[model samples]
Target: MGQRTTVATTFGSAVRESVGSSLAAVDAELARRYPGDAGTRQPVHTVYVPADVFTAGTVREWGDRALAALDEHAPDAEAFAAVLGLPGELAGPVHERVRAKLEREPVEDLRIDFEDGYGPRPDAEEDAAAARAARLVAEAYADGTAAPYMGVRVKCMEAAVRDRGIRTLDVFLTGLMEAGGLPGGLVLTLPKVSYPEQVVAMARLAGEFETAHGLAEGRIRFEIQIETTQAILGADGRATVARLIDAGAGRVTGLHYGTFDYSAACGVGAAHQAPDHPVADHAKAVMQVAAAGTGVRLSDGSTNVLPVGTTARVHEAWRLHHGLVRRSLARAYYQGWDMHPGHLPTRYAAVYAYYREGLERAAARLVAYTERAGGDVLDEPATARALSGHLLRGLDCGAVGTAEVTGLTGLDRAALERLAGRPAGRGF
Candidate 1:
């Protein structure tokens, strides 16, 4: 109505600045919560043994026994080469390297499983077993014989067995702290999680245990097993993995796939409950999508076809197990479960072959891409990351040495380390 009304154009800038600041804060918070990858050394596989059978340095002892059996059966590098499908020229070196690794650090991760592996027992007996495990863990720590990563797998939080799970965890933690405090890099594995509430409850309980033991908050991290249908698809008919992670409140270290139970939940026949089955792939993809860039690790389930006896049938079973492990490796799941000591050879064989097969090409491509030399080759940041990750994993698992990596990539040790730590393209 007025003759000289002036519009306040400054308001838009103020609104923009305020919104930008708020968004920045939110982005910072998200980074803090998710925080990219942890850069920790993830074990290639976790070996589970029954709690009752566990003893101090049992992992080492079992590995030594397994090596003796392997020697008895395979006898020499050529014999082992036939089983691993390696060139005759590579047989002796591969055999000696694996043997030395087994002798030195046979078990990267060990799980004293109180769930399926140890079934149900009387409360008193279960408590005693938990105490024994605690004593063994402490002794392993004192003797420096503990695996680089170790944990205990408690039972599910189903209403019928929730108390048992809690009691076992409580007893184990109490005994562990009373003995010598929690071991470094120790984690708890919570199996058969079916709901976000289950994750929340477990995290809350872990927090309580830490507090009671005077340990720092978030010191007790746990891995969740995605076993049930509800675990993948929430009761609300939505994929609930992200929800589960959020419920963990930053204590979730990994999400492990449970092949058999998940297959059974989908009504798949036992004969068809396979790792690479379409349904299993779907669940793993969901987990990957949910956990990508969240710093939470992923592990595949085990192949139950154990190589037990020394017969043609046993060798066939070993071949099948090797194929399964290879398939898992191809899918970028560097970690899986090893159910029996007999699985060790195939585990290392598949892993080593995977890295070795891709080494030359991956190194060449990475070097070219890093130098910005296109040369009719198309390379993306994702490819660079994958190559770097492969090499880093190979180094971590002792499948390849630092000298080999540096030689192949033409990068010095420090550069390789920096490349491994960098976020792909930025450094490349």
Candidate 2:
């Protein structure tokens, strides 16, 4: 009966055009919100060195220095074991293993800083230094001494130093290109990005550099330093982190929080500026939310305390750094900045302890979840992914070996490998 009186539905040209335009807008917005594939191999930490102090083999040198300091302070594996609160039986072996790892791969990521680290120099001198850094990096790449992740931090793009930043970046890129084609995993860091426009400008400059050097169009990615209050809260009073990433036009690989600068922006006194300060926490939280699942990696700021001088002072410095690193790792930030060679040992120690301490529980939970398929354990996909990631990350950072993970989780090598290859948010 209803079919006998059926009515046809049609849209006028104007209405159809309007609907099409709205759909296109929605599609564009969705595309903008989509998180693209983040590259593989996010390093556990980044070591920042003054450009002047940088050399081709600086990573290995730092590792050697760290081991030497350990020898001087701890003297024996047992003493070092006490420092980390590790069992007496496991201390010596762990110490040797960590030392070997450090010597072999002292720095996962290295940043040659031209900002506070290098300060301002004569234009010609800065240019020469940039070129020299490029040459060293080139040599390091050729010699297989380059860190897996390496980059330079150029000055902020604020008006006062915008041109300076651009010039330094250009000089560095040109120098690096002349020395050799751009190395893999190389990223330029644009610091003190207080506005989205700064990110856009940096992206444009990177594109220009790539084109000028005949590099791939998207080869010149950069990291944004969330240093100022303005960077967190844009001029419009909205969260700016996502906007900043968008401004990078898919060239932003990481967002690193600058603890001191952010604390100073909050008017915290120098004595109060620490990585674990509430102010820093707020900044990191903002960054985490803004960049979560966006494929842009996040890094916490450095612990300014350096382990130097007498044994007592060195031990004290190590304690402070360890606390900071532990706090960062607890907060799910796998990467932070190491300001000195002395920070290397504590960085690895803290990271290893964090992962090692939780391995047993995490592995058990993961196995149960995988077997039961989420029954009494209340395991969600997120939980499974996180558990899998923990062990995989432990392996990646050299905190544990494949044999250990397999033994602990009852997962064969193939299973662990499968978990390692699985992206986040996927079921095991």
Best model number under TM-score = 1
1-428 per-residue lDDT for model 2 (tens digits): 55577678787889988988889988787666655434266788888888988887688889899888888998777887677667665565567767877888888999999998899889998898888888888888888888987879988988887888889888888888888788875878888888888888988998887777787888889899999998888777899888998888888989999988889999999998998899999888999988876778899998787899998898888888888888888898999999888888888888877777777788888888778754456877676767777787787778877888888778864565455445443321
**Can you tell me which runs of candidate 1 are displaced by over 4 Å?**
1-19, 87-90, 412-414, 422-428
Give the Cα error of residue 320 in candidate 1, in Å. 0.9
- Give stretches of model 2 more than 4 Å off: 1-32, 36-39, 87-93, 373-376, 410-428
Q: Between which residue pairs do clashes occur in model 2?
A: none
> Among all windows of ten consecutive residues in candidate 2, which has the lowest summed lDDT?
419-428
State the displacement of the C-alpha of residue 403, model 1, in Å, after optimal TM-score superposition: 1.8
- lDDT for model 2, on a 0 to 1 scale? 0.82
lDDT for 424 in candidate 1 is: 37
- lDDT measured at residue 10 in model 1 versus the true structure, 0 to 100: 58
Per-model TM-score on C-alpha atoms:
0.90, 0.88
Model 1 lDDT tens row, 256-315: 999899999999999999888899999999998999888899999987777777656567
